[model samples]
Target: MSLPTTTKEYFWKELGSLANLSFRESKLPPLKSHEVLVKIHAVSLQYRDLVIGLGQYPANVRDQLVACSDMAGEVILAGKDAGSEWKPGDRVSANFCADHIAGETTLEIQQTAHGGPIHGVLTQYKSFRPHSLVRIPEHLSYEEASTLPCAALTAYNALMGPVPVKSGDTVLILGTGGVSIHGLQFALASGAKVIVTSSSDEKLKIATKLGAQHVINYNKTPEWQEKILEITGGRGVDHILDVVGALDQTLKAIRIGGWIHTIGFLNGTAADVSLGNLMKVCYIRGVNIGSVAQFKDMNRLLASHPEVTRPVVDKVFAFEETLQAYNYLQSQAHVGKVVIKVV
Candidate 1:
């Protein structure tokens, strides 16, 4: 089947802030060599998108950015060198960190497809390099697969890389948000005892159901780190997945020679990160979303771990309800990934 050369493409445009976001149709761009055209099937809403739309992403892109990063779609056109690996009808997901296909951090490749650096995937159809995507797992629906490219991949990288997790390690995750939830699953699958902390006792209950070995209501137990020590018989946790960079709660919670991976500062970024905290760290690393290659490896790992699924997909909205999805995610009342079905 031949690809549609052009079509009336629908996309959400950013005129200014989140207040100015509107859905509109415009001419679609033609597919270029090494570029594959995908018909977007689902777009998941993320807080970072809200921050980008509101002009708060740490390195905000040029204004009027498309304003979303995670999306799953089907390939309709493959570039000349793209090979037959992905042709029309393949279900695949795009990696938000498009250029970091191999190796560790390099400023050059990191700039290319990061949501802040270029046009993102908020549109109905998007063009990406054939090398920049991974096939959705066979058992997952588009929306479920859509959850991985950004949030899940980062969680996988932060938990698994630079040092592979081993059995019996204590993994502490803050918040019951998407990344933390996903990190919780991966940690459990790795045979580690997972501890989740949240202000909501209700959410902590849900976390326990999802394989969290322990839960801390950060509200009542403001000294949750003490709870971690108590839970582990005062050994302290070996690794912490810090999605909320709330001050140095994560730093204080970790044991001496422990690692903390920062994926977000939802808790607050301004808090002090003392040298004393670092004095004992095995590694306090910052994870950007992972590369296309790492994404594929993660998929392989995910396929084996049935426990690793999208934790709390609270609602699904129609394609035209993209705005509603964004608003719902911003509300933060939802437990899991809030997704929009885009045909």
Candidate 2:
């Protein structure tokens, strides 16, 4: 198949609002050796995408940058020296940090993160280093697989990263957003008893249907940590995915020596860390998504449980409805992922 000479994409011409986003056709450059051209099939919205648009994200974005990070696409062409790893019609997703193939993330790796410091995969076509892309699971659609680049992988690293959650452990997920919901699924798949918290009982009900063993309505029960203790027979949970940045309460509900993977700060960044809470000997670590190796590992699990582990897509919008999709994500009404069908 012949590659297109130009591709349509959305760009953040200026930051501070979704209105700054503009669409236009961009010249598709020829692929270099070791690069593969992808025809992006879908793009998923992340909270960071909104943060970048609002100029609230703690990174420097380039002028007129392509918007968003997560995407699932097909390799439409491979450069001469790209090897046989990628070819026409190969389903793939790029790692969030393109350069960080494995091991610990560094300042250099952080700069390579898409949507902020670098151009993202929101375009109809883009060239990628073959090493940076991973073959997605056969069971997932482009929309479902698009969500994996960031949200799903973050949750996987939270649960299965250093000090992995295991069978018989108890995991407390803070909200029903993309990462938290994926955490719920991963925790359940690991045979761990899962508890999920949300301000909306309606969202909590959806969490229940998604296999959360215990659900907490934080609006009704402000001191939900105490309730977590009661539910866990006064032992507290083994691991906590602190998506809400509610450290004070999370520390209260964490088991002694438990792990709290600090994933997001939806509420705010400031947290009160008391000495009493510190004495619990619990470990609080920040998760910055995962590596290419880890992403591949997560895909292996997704492939194995194809029937049960599909991503929860809240809604899919057409490519022309990109602004509406961003608005929907900003409203925080969606349960899981908000996707855009680029095809």
Measured by TM-score, the strongest candidate is 2
If scored against the real structure, what TM-score would every candidate get?
0.92, 0.98
TM-score for candidate 1, please give it. 0.92
| CA deviation > 4 Å runs, candidate 2 | none
lDDT of 2 by residue, 254-340 (tens): 999999999765666565678878888999899999899999999998987775568999999999999999999999999999999
lDDT tens per residue, model 1, 142-203: 88887888788889889888877778899998888788888888888888989999889888
Give candidate 1 regions above 4 Å deviation: 5-16, 269-281
Q: What CA RMSD would candidate 1 show?
A: 2.1
Q: Give the Å error, residue 85, model 1.
A: 1.8
Model 2 quality (TM-score): 0.98
- Tell me the lDDT of candidate 1: 0.78
